[model samples]
Target: MNLNNIHNVYFIGIGGIGMSALARYFYVNKKHVVGYDKTQTNITNGLIDLGIEVHFEDSIKNIDSKFLNSNNTLVVYTPAVPNTHSELNFFLSKGFYVLKRSQVLGLITENTFCLAVAGTHGKTTTTSILGHLMNECNVPVTAFLGGISENYNSNLILNGTDVSVVEADEFDRSFLTLSPDLACITSMDADHLDIYGDASELEKSFKDFSKKIKPNGKLFVKNGLPLTGITYGIEDDSDYSIHNIKIENGTYIFDVKTPKTVLENLQFNLPGRHNLSNALIALAMAVQYGCPHRQLAKALASYKGVKRRFTYHIKTQNLVFIDDYAHHPEEINAVYQAVREMYPNKKVLAIFQPHLYSRTKDFADDFAISLAQFDELLLLDIYPARELPIDGVTSEWLLNKVNNKNKRLVSKDELLLEIHKTSANVILTIGAGDIGEEVKHIKKELSIAS
Candidate 1:
């Protein structure tokens, strides 16, 4: 599909992080952009601020007349949208140039020198870091991030189009559509079991994605992953490794050992070893792409990080509040480790909102074990983003499995009250669903109490 020929671009689920990024990309490219989302959100508000029309309702009448012309309009829909979505069905019935968000991403990056980051975890952070590095080094690049970058305060980094940076998402095997010139896999954990049905199939998908790399192109893998390529890890013997790691004033000061030479005194402010590893792979990919190590180091240090990856809403010596998008068990463990490593002495109270019914049922034991690490826990009901509720899979069931004695299930209405009763100094609101919407209120209430 020639994007130049399409004058109008419409998004069916415009509030999603990935979809909004694409919307921004088209808007910047001078296309007439409009979209429909089920609800108004900060993302939709930001899009509206850019003069791109956005409506919340799914009615056909909500769509502007200009976008009804199939010849000049291209329709993009996310898989998360229901099959019964009226706008999506209308576009399909009209036989407009309809494409999945991933398909459109693949088409956009096909001609460019693409750098894609693929993994169950760390895709957003790794892609954001790489995008920042390439953009800082003055590479003519356009980056479509899966999350909003704090440095740019936007998901689409619009520098130039010669090189494209994107998160090669693996949901529904979406990354298969992207053929990247340079690619990296940060992890291959057993996730999205509802999609792949088992762990082995998920691993197979990553292997398939590795093959999608262009001929003679490079692939970077986390050192222990079951893939043959340049490997990166922290404080270990790998193709690209970080050593001399230490924290000073909450920022990491480490030296990266690449195949060529050691890049010393590199600074990254993001907490957690996972984020440090993310920075390492981004650095390794940038080094292989011929970006000067000196410039890359500066960019890595300058990166503020992707929003909700490990965002600190309130940080003080007396009280600390952090919000993160860690729905999977492995992600939860990473968050736990980071919190413990940073605040070893403080008592942490974790409030978690499980994301999906299938995921909760599939990894209930693992989630319980991960959540048990906290001193206290407040469990919320499943968000049920795409799936219907599964019988016998509930927050109370998961809470019972947790070994921690100080755990209880709470509703959103009771969340603030439960939080007030906790004696823990460190407060964490964790999940990937509408739990994020509570961050502002949580921060405000906690700030006043502190």
Candidate 2:
């Protein structure tokens, strides 16, 4: 278990966001890093460009020979990989030291001052904000984020080695492995039912994560999230809250009132009240970590935000396009609020691709209500990332429950053509699936037509 003894690091699912971050970290540290993924992506290509060996096939032969030795090679894998993967089995049967992505994160941050952000939503944005705050304050911090940060243009932010920031994911109970010096739970909504089976079980898992904070550490929670922690919210009686909020030129400008300080005129370019809350939580954590109030305030104002989380693809007087990863019903509602608040007079069109079949079946009614907020809607067939189809849970069934008359179901192939025919002033592509793979094409088409 002594990491210093290992010379080669190999990943089973290296193209995944978190796993790629880890691979990049080892590569930067001058270790031999190689990985196997089922497919290639922009992320994997970036890693390859950095001289990290990456192969698409799952065969054991693709693994570098240096990593074949059990004593010197360390294996890491994502939970999404199947048990029967060829390369994974080779390492396992040969007695390589294997670790889950979460376990490796836990091991790396154990000796540092860790700031962990846990929630069903908002974890990536909040963690990215916290990392920016620390970096701006000249703190020696490293952050492993779930999404590519627009500010840093990378998921791994390496400032120094003394402190660390991480998104404490709740899926597969991964957050349980982290013991944070300071932790926050942004929201505890029911999600990932395929893993927990019910909302109460999900809440119980979060409570356990809250208890994992160090004895001397602090815990921040949304004001009324049914948890006992130092509270945070917007314009409410919490330890920290955003007050005097205003929007200028489509940006959020606000003041944060912490327990002992009222930081003034903190500006953020990201949209939605939910994002404002995310910024406030990050600000509070920075202050608690001894970052100067003025430093944290400046960092908040300068943050560009995480990509695909309310990302603006086009913004002209004649047209506006946004892409967001809002898979859950509550997340979609937040996206709806941000779009309507920003352009109340415009005719908004929402194009959503449901992520998972089980999730679509579990929250069909809520999804219908949230998607109905748009002036027009286009529902694509469920992306079905990890699940097979469920009977009677098609996009057509969900479309019928929507209140909007302008709604229609379309396949990914017909999406651009249908979009070309619509008279949309504001365009929003909302989903957590591979629909994001279509954002650039949609943006290019709309940009040229307009």
| Model 2: residues with Cα > 4 Å off, grouped in runs | none
Clashes of each: 0, 0
Please, what is the whole-model Cα lDDT of each candidate in the order they appear? 0.93, 0.91
Candidate 1 lDDT over 381-446, as tens digits, reads 999998998999999999999999899999999999999999998999999999999999998888
lDDT for model 2, please: 0.91
* Candidate 2 lDDT, 1-450, residue by residue in tens: 777788999998899999999998888888899999887888999999999999898787787668768998899999889888988888899999999999999998999999999999999999999999999999999999999999999999999989999999999999999999999999999999999999999999999999999999989999889889889999988889889999999888888887786888888888899998898899889999999987777788899988889999999999999999999999999998888888889999999999898898889899988998889999999987767789998999999999999999999999999999899899999998888899999998997898
What's the alpha carbon RMSD for model 1?
A: 0.9
CA RMSD (A), model 2: 1.0
TM-score list, all predictions: 0.99, 0.98
